[model samples]
Target: MATKKTQILILPYPIQGHINPMLQFAKRLASKSRHLILTLLLPTSHARSISSHIGSINVQPISDGADQQGQQFQTAETYLQQFQRAVPGSLDDLIRLERGHDQPQPTILIYDSFFPWALDVAHSNGLAAAPFFTQTCSVSSVYFLFKEGRLSDEMELPHGIPRLEQRDLPSFIQDKENSAHLLELLVDQFSNLDEADYVFFNTFDKLENQMVEWMARQWQVLTVGPTIPSMYLDKCVKDDRSYGLNLFKPNRESCRDWLCERRASSVIYVSFGSMAILKQEQIEEIAKCLENLQTRFIWVVRETEMAKLPSEFVEWNLSSGLGLVVTWCNQLDILAHETVGCFVTHCGWNSVLEALCLGVPMVGVPNWSDQPTNAKFVEDVWKVGVRAKEDEDGIVKSMVLEKCVRAVLEGEKGEVVRRNAGKIKRWALEAVQLGGSSDNNIAKFVTGLALKD
Candidate 1:
């Protein structure tokens, strides 16, 4: 008799940052073993956006209640509530449907850590569960401590981790009064983690060795990432150039053309990611900073944020032939481009990993959530970039931004920064290559799953 094949269901929270990393991980799993079948489970609303482009991977679109009712009018909080309420039932139906078809029954469910409720669904359905954490191990460690109420005044910092002042913690923890909802969501990630069969972090052993080791002592933890596409790292997987999902259309041709005209390491790339909303004053400050630098640049100002730009900033900057403003562009392409020198970013984990992988120095203008902690590391721990200091009013002044950018682009410090960036890039490359730490972990995971089957 033939052996029963193993089917693994991978689910991400319905957002660009969450979906991209998990999707990349699914690709890695698929590439690692033919014995395992991979299925990406996305909310019906988000799946519609990238269903066509996610080639080769099976996507199972499960309803999120709000989608069936018309998501156009739902608030973020309401949408999440509905998703939590609706996904369990949708997941039950999906599992049953898959079994009824020619496909093998899903034996394992890999879910985003943000939704601990998925663990319950997995156990009740007789499937093993693993939680994939999208944040850095450092940030995740903080959340873990907070969840266990160990972040008190007397709590000692982990040995390998940096000392985190209150200001360096995720915004939700630092300002619980204003971010109670998000704090609740973050802390809830650890509620049922003890019951999970395994836990995965989107980081590599070399990058966070001490913390990864510490976390493993508590759970069946695995470090299986820097989960970007293969083409950018080791090129192990054929034609794997992108995460294969773009919620917003990218200005691919225009971005390429503009960057092509610039000299190597002469352009500044600016993007705040898909979700961060900069205040009008902050936007204007960044505009002034770019003008003061007087260098070739590409800025991604999403359409919703266009109104926040200072009047005539784009038109005048474009007329001067110093800047090109687009709604969105392929960030990896830009970061990997020879013309790009420094990345001004919101310090999102996805962007941070991409920059580290590409060896691009950064100027972090972190806005909220885990960004503050990420920025802290980018400047202090990694030594690959500088984080702009915000004034008392919490806006990075144009002068401060200019200094940070200049620090990364010129002078003796720039040389040191570039060296660190290059070193980190090599580590990232090795982490995903054949026989590397992440690759080994991925292979081990597949082996375990196949053995269980």
Candidate 2:
């Protein structure tokens, strides 16, 4: 009789944040299990980047023929259609690539929550498929709620719910027309989750005990979080890997030098995640507000120019020596820096976790999707941040932005927020230590997935 082999194929949604977590999970699996062979199904563009950062794992770039169009690739719908057409054939190709090897074929498909087609592909191929929820368990519950028709409208959530809002819904689920189709797709996809061996969430059980319990009653749910720490531990014990997975080219020197000059806990760092684009007017407003506050800041401004800024406004801080603006920066490193006091953020999950881990307070400026809910958690529940108000036009005004910045930086409440953030940071660090909830959950997840064997 032949020895049984376990092959796990990981297919992540082709975006930076999603891809990063999936890669970390793959790395963790690789470290613990020799019986498991890992194959990452990635975009052609991302293949080289991911491969460079990860260890001895096979990266198979899916060829959709759409990538040949290059710059012409416009909408999400187009990418989805192309991916749907390509993934099945790509999976077959990967299987063929594995067949001549001295190992078993892929027995499990580990996929992102957004990729519903993975379930279909895995079922057709007689393989178990596990969905990886990259966001918080709270956010995932909201998604499941929407699918169950618990929420009537998309724009604004029904008011009396103590813990959540309609804005907590995922980006694609924010529109009624779009959400109808999305909920239908999610319902179909999630209904078959029981067929999968297990589902993995990038959050610890202690962090969300209620949601984890609810999910466990439905399907096998494994909570594994702060994957970065796990990756760091792996590096420390194993190969001394300097970095995990980062797709974007970060601006490092400028921000670090700026941080070096500032006093400890004095500079504010501001960044919206990659996808949130600001209007030229909005950008100008933010610039003006930052200038008005007269505090030292490190701002990540992706776009080159803003139309509404006066000529003087553009030149206001060019040589002012108090602000450092860059297109992108090494955010994790900056957050961990001593001089960094607060974050003015778009409230993406990864950013929130990073801030919490570093004990840095924030000025929450939730742009869209689940960000408002994230803001609510930070401001209301965590007591680590303050929310900026939206004007009558529902736009966040310059004055409001300035006020929130000042509140986070200098107000009496800011001191309280700072202390709360520090406490959360201590708890976050403790959670990752031996005997801590996050540490214990990782072990449990590994054992449940049979990766420990």
Q: What lDDT does the true structure give each of the candidates? A: 0.89, 0.71
Deviating ranges (above 4 Å) for candidate 2: 1-5, 48-53, 67-71, 96-100, 152-174, 178-189, 229-243, 303-310, 448-453
Q: Per-residue alpha-carbon lDDT of model 1 for 1-453, expressed as tens digits?
A: 877778899989988999889989988988877767788988887777656437667887888876778857446777787888899999888877776888788999999998898889888889999999999888998988887778876668785667887778899998999888889999999898899999999999888888888988988999989999888999988778898887889999999988998899999999999998899999999999998999888999999999998877777785798999999999999999999999999999999999999999999998899999999989898899998989888999999999999999999999999999999999999999999999999999988988887
The TM-score of candidate 1 is 0.97
RMSD of each: 1.4, 3.7
* Residue pairs in candidate 2 whose N, alpha carbon or C atoms collide under 3 angstroms: 157-166
lDDT of 2 by residue, 1-453 (tens): 643557788898887778777777676666655766778788775575555335756677776655666644576556766777777777766665665577667777888887777777777776778888887767666667666767554444322223555454455566657656445544555666777677888766545566677777877787766665343332332542423555656788878877888899888798988778776667777887878888888888775443444567658887677788777778877998999988999998888888887788988777766677778778887789887876654467779998887787777988999999988777766666676675676566556556422
Residue pairs whose backbone atoms clash in candidate 1: none
Error of 2 at 397 (Å): 1.4
